[model samples]
Target: MIVAPPDPVVLAGLATTRPGPAGASLLRAGLHARRLLLLKTLLVRVQRHRETVAPAVLRGFEAGWLLLERAERARPDVVRAVLDYPTTGAWLAAALTEPLGPGLDRHLAHLELLAVTAALRAGVEVDLVVDTPGGVLPLPGVGRVESGGAGRLRIDARSRAVRIGGGDGTGSRAVLRRRANGPARTLTGSGPGWRGLRALPGGATRLEDLDPYRLPPDMGIPARAAADHADTDHAGWADRWTAARRLLRGTDRERAIEVGRSVDAVVPLVPRGTRAIGATLSAAPGAVLMTPSAGAADMAETLVHELHHSKLATLHELVPLHRPHPPGRAAPTYRVGWRTDARPVAGVLQGVYAHLALADLWHRAARGSRAPGLPERWRVRSAQRFDHVHDQVVEALAILLESDELTNEGREFARQMRKHLASLSSGRRALA
Candidate 1:
């Protein structure tokens, strides 16, 4: 695959946290292309290390790859849906990073589940056996199936219908349908051992199941027991998300479009009062782990903030924004004014980029009646938020500009960020 460098103009726009429609499209295309390359690399690595991997796992992976390839030829869109899911990239990163051992085999074998999902969605005929050590088959974007016992799970798919049977004669059947004019595929299951996936009210994002590879490795949550408690409150979650989407579209249609494109799923976290909590994993491009307690405005803001992180993460993968810390030497850290602890240069860069967007968000919110039906108190709070985030962004930008750890591209990016912040500051003063 030919990898093209990101356009400098697009990079600059992204640094300002305002990649317009064209820039956003370019970024998404670049990210998708790179992910496809990563998938190919993963397949080759598994093939190279076949001896170390378990025979069953190896066979599963090989069969899955063939099915995936055939599905891609038949329905590239369906295959892309499975491959482009955020957790697929995270799983690939983990599988590639680990050494050749049981851990690696387990990670690599996840590709079989992913491939099966694609085949089912594409309506390709496939009868494949996959190892489900714990009797649970967690399809990446689809729902999970519990076989009631740990052993081999046989999946037979023909014409968009799939039947999953376990060694103990337990079985279930699900029908997959590709939504009209949308890339999302829905699966409805009957009989025992099937838990269908649920989407938020707008159907734009999936409430992701408890897939072990869903979270980054650093989170350290156990796979089988990592089910989210927030799933119980789907009604409330959907209501807030619908409101959040409205608020976002009201605030800025372009930004709302960006968020919609950037995020595919929300891994709901247990609520912590009314405080909003959100996190994005560099490995997982389109997934956000967020609590469900936030109000519409707060949820909207969190989505925007996390979208910046997601964009920057994808950009970093394509272009080196900051150099890694010197080997055997501790990386320098600095206070970015948002977090209590001092952060490394890379962390500071991420903070600066995300806060820059937040500053823009509140700046627009505070300036007159751009957001229709916004309460007076909301405008007042928006002004306060703008002030806080603007200051934090200024402090973080200074750190980024002064750091020697940045690449030439990174320095240029920081300079563009500083210029953009100056523009926003001038606008604030004009409003005053």
Candidate 2:
């Protein structure tokens, strides 16, 4: 259960809307190659509706899309990882029912590609059974399928014998999780636990059945809001939640459990066209605020990123990572490869540490190759990308150590980071 800080005011700037397309911002800001592909997806969505899209939206989306297209062709693996994702369906459903005005620059766009990568690792598969009238819908990896009931779609997972569809009283939307395996039971949702492997949270039977009271307060994510709750009926949000929680269990169960236990609460950020898909507050420890992600992989990584913050927050109480910037000497700033924004030493440290975990995650992902149909070339490329991130982190660590920010403990921590990086590098070299 999440504990509340007394009189916790909602974090300000909860709704910062940038006018341009979210994809363009990603390109201009410079994102990792894996993420760049996701920006292109948002652009693709814009192009499909160019005639109807607003000028700012079309211009930004097209500019970013064209830039990426000219520089590189969209990889088949990247595309398949995306379009075939379960959350992509939920995101599309949300966009259709809830209109958020012009300039559809939601961070959720990036989540699509991230989900693709994560779901593949989870060993989870699904087939979208849609009820459409006319032509066969081309769903990249899944191929063409026919449907009759115009706006209705059903998601089925044969492996788990689980199906999510309309029948649980959400009207056109299917938020209820009906276990079709043995006896029929309509579960609201579940959390991080994997049955038998780990115990579920108290009172929670299904993974998608989240404890609303355990939700954090500062980040603006609603805990109690659901399909039945007015103003909280976020179309496909319920389904998206189910997919994210399940993916976490399937792909990164241990880490998910760690996060659930450490973090006080998660605040779901409404998409406001910002480049950041997720964020954690230094002021408000254990609180993570984020937009809906593209898929399970995206959610998994986002959890990793924010949970790193939670860990660091706990450590910060004990040891300082950096000394305060000298009074009046323009605070030192450095470029974070993940973002276009320049960050101070503290911010950079935060990013570097989080990315250290991500780098390692991808490194392990590259080595094992558990995901079916993942290409060899893509694996090599991913390994190279994460190695590059590791190198950057090492560099950042060096620069930080040189500065006078070390309490004996901080220096030791920095050394440990370097030691870990060196070990990972050596292991990769041996593999090569």
Candidate 3:
């Protein structure tokens, strides 16, 4: 029988040292776990006929860190086994319940947040490895004990690069690198990746890679025509609108404008959309919604990161629609995501995904402007180093589909995104 999330009894007093093994016993306690495996097989089968979950593009992730956080607490052993060897504190942090106390616990939140935040900040790799023999198991999402495979990740904050081992035994990988410490840096990658495996019976592993420090070809797309549609938040918006309109046109033009709107509307959802772009809920619901924006573009990029929460909400629990927290639990903070203008050389070098892509984009854009290949292009090139800042929403949007944390769309949208991004940023690789 497949084990469900940790028992509240066991969970209330889980060990700090060994969570993985301990969590496995909870599975034995459940009577219908075997049925769940059967259900997974049937559901995956249904996807072959129809679609699985939602399209990855419209959403950012199939699961979010918070959802994973709760599941981990329910099953400590599964987490320990799948996550490799986390520290006692790390495991405790991973097993921590949403604090229903009066206030947010930065210390406890730090552990779980650091696990994911640091992974993204440092570029830790994460992916699924499905095992159909046992049933259909998503990597890191479930453990072998439950018939679903566990996640295999190599986290190195010092190296600033996260490599997902893919719990399903797939070789898919995603990476983020930085060029400096600036806000809104490059986020190069394979774009979105394909779902499940190809028809090898085992499956095809499609990984999107990111090379943040590179620039895509400049296809003479004008950027100034959209000045009329620019958000009137600040002078920077006027400049970026006028500047981008002066440089880009056609598909790039339209995409840029849409991207611009998403980033510019990232005000808090309680306020129901801010100066930033879009706002979507995470598993925690209500308090946190993604808002991706940049100073020049507002908080659109910030909204993108927040939106990831909405996309990955399902992983919060295996059961349906049960709130992850009690009525009084603290909500996931918007601070979980961010954007920057400078490069994140140290972050990537330190192995963090935080603003790593933006950093790489900024550095590359800067270098491209200095290149002798072009004979004094437009003045915009001089400030192009921070171009990634303007596109944070784009990255956020792609993550819903492309990122391992959430696989919302199918391959078709994933491929389209790859082609579009590949065409834009001077041959930068995908986040695949």
> Model 1 — TM-score against the truth?
0.91
Sort order, TM-score high to low? 1, 2, 3
- What would the per-residue lDDT of candidate 1 be over residues 332-359, giving only the tens digit for each residue? 9898688898999999999988888988
Model 1: colliding residue pairs: none
lDDT of 2 by residue, 236-338 (tens): 4445545545544444455445555444344454465544366665433444556667655566567667767645543444335467777978987877667
Cα-lDDT of candidate 1: 0.77
Q: Ranking by lDDT, best first? A: 1, 2, 3
Per-candidate TM equals 0.91, 0.44, 0.20
How far residue 407's Cα lies from its native spot in candidate 1, in Å, is: 1.4
Global local distance difference test of model 2: 0.44
Which regions of candidate 3 are displaced past 4 Å? 1-280, 283-294, 298-300, 303-413, 425-432
Q: Count the backbone clashes (under 3 Å) in each candidate.
A: 0, 16, 135
Q: Quantify all predictions' global Cα lDDT against the true fold.
A: 0.77, 0.44, 0.28
